[model samples]
Target: MRNTFDFTPLFRSGIGFDRMLNALEAASRVETVDNWPPYDIAKKGEDDYRITMAVAGFSQDELDITQEHNMLMVSGQKPAEDNAEYLHHGIAERAFRRRFELADHVKVVNASLVNGLLTIDLKREIPEEMKPRRIEIGSVKAKPKAEAKQIEADNQAA
Candidate 1:
């Protein structure tokens, strides 16, 4: 099925959300189905996340996971065995590249592989000043009468 929608009005509105618009444009260009390597992304806690990839025939030494420039890159290369005598080799034993976009302040905690599953953990650390805080609005009281009068005289002189 084919579908169409008018986007001219949105472009002309000038709302000034350039970052979101650029992200949408970039997402539209991505080919989701082309790279079929199975993977899973899960949230471990309030600020922790995990990414797991299914790599059946890959060795731990052949796989690599790295974080660079706000991007998580997972790659692997499997070399063919020397004494392979199988009539039909259906399993995928080739090189692959996978990318995951990381948010600001998010960082890689650690990575490990066990039982053909590669797990990568991540955590986001928010600064103390950035977190929400309670303000004592009602606790702030007015100054004394003498202090108020002195401030008034100073203001009048100014």
Candidate 2:
């Protein structure tokens, strides 16, 4: 059984959330999901995030990581091997591609591969102008009555 969601109600009341609603709609639709090369996403800090993938037998050169706008793609391709007979070919040695949707200002800070695991670090850096700031409310002082009377007398003498 497949379930879908209607985002029309949200659209009527929400503004500037088109991208988020579209992403949710895409996720709700069922598709052939490839489970190979399992991955994990964790939040290390307030604005720090990490994505780790189990890529056993995949070398650094064979893997590619790219970021286009708000999308993160990680793909792996193993060079074709010559005729090698295996008694039981149980290991999954195939090319696979994975994608992750990133929020605005979220950037890939670093990537490292260790012990057949690929770890990618991300950081969200909001611009100074976009951050919330405090506004100062100052008191408005009234002019003295003596100074006002002096100005009025000067105008009368002129």
Candidate 3:
């Protein structure tokens, strides 16, 4: 059974979270997503992440990876053979495309294909200005204007 949700109420009350709400709505709306090639997402370190996808029988030339802003797309298409005869076709070589949504400041650093597994490394590089910093607090002493001027005059006279 498929499920659906209405985000109109969330849109009215929520502030500065449009992207997150939209992603949730889109995920809920997707009913038939192809699960041909399995994938896994894991965190390597505090700011490093890795995504591994099973892409058997796919070469580097046949695969395509693209990133636009916070969206990553991976697609593969096997070239058709000129003369091939198969009694029972079992392996799936059809074209497939997959998308991944990335958070802000997360970037794709590297990608590699080995042993039919596609590994993509991601690193989160937050800007210095956006990072949290500590502010030093100090006490201030107030002095009267007339006394300050008198002390300055006395110092000048001496």
Candidate 4:
């Protein structure tokens, strides 16, 4: 059974959160989970993250990684295999594509393939202006009386 939610009311009231709501709706959908070429995501530091995938049979040329907006896609395509007779085929040699959703300001730093693992490093860089800062609050000064008197004298002269 799949649990579905009604976001109509939220949409009617909320603003500037369409992307998050869309992601939530997409996640709520019932879809088949792909287990092949399993991967792991880990947080290395406060602003650093890593993704590791077990791609045992894939080569550097056969794998691809791309980031578009907030989406990260990784795909692997195996070359053609020669025809051979096999009694029992247990190994999985197939093409696979995986995607990950990245948060705003998160960017891919580096990627490396070692042995059978594909590792990708990521970091979140918040712009200086977007970061929080203490606002200076000083006493509000009253309007100068000289300027008010000058305005009144000018009006009388006019």
RMSD of each: 7.7, 4.8, 6.8, 5.2
Q: What does candidate 3's lDDT look like per residue over 50-152, in tens digits?
A: 9999999999999999999999999999998657788888887779999999999999999999999999999999999999999999878876566444333
* Candidate 4 deviant stretches above 4 angstroms: 144-158
Each prediction's whole-model lDDT (CA): 0.81, 0.94, 0.92, 0.92
Counting clashing residue pairs in each candidate, in order, gives: 0, 0, 0, 0
Model 1, span 90-117: residue lDDT tens: 9888789898988767999889889989
Selected candidate, larger TM-score, 2 vs 4: 4
The reply for model 1, stretches above 4 Å from the true place, is 1-17, 80-86, 134-158
Best by lDDT: 2
| Worst-scoring 10-residue span by lDDT in model 2 | 149-158
TM-score of each: 0.69, 0.83, 0.81, 0.86
What tens digits encode model 4's per-residue C-alpha lDDT throughout 94-133?
A: 9999999999999999999999899999999999999999
lDDT of residue 157 for candidate 3: 50
Per-residue lDDT of candidate 2, residues 1-158 (tens digit): 67789999999999999899999999898679899899999999999999999999999999999999999999999999769988988778799999998999999999999999999999999999999999999999987666444333444653
Pitting candidate 1 against candidate 4, the one with the higher TM-score is 4
User: Model 2: residues >4 Å from true position, as ranges?
Assistant: 138-158
lDDT of 4 at 73: 97
Error of model 1, residue 55, in angstroms: 0.8
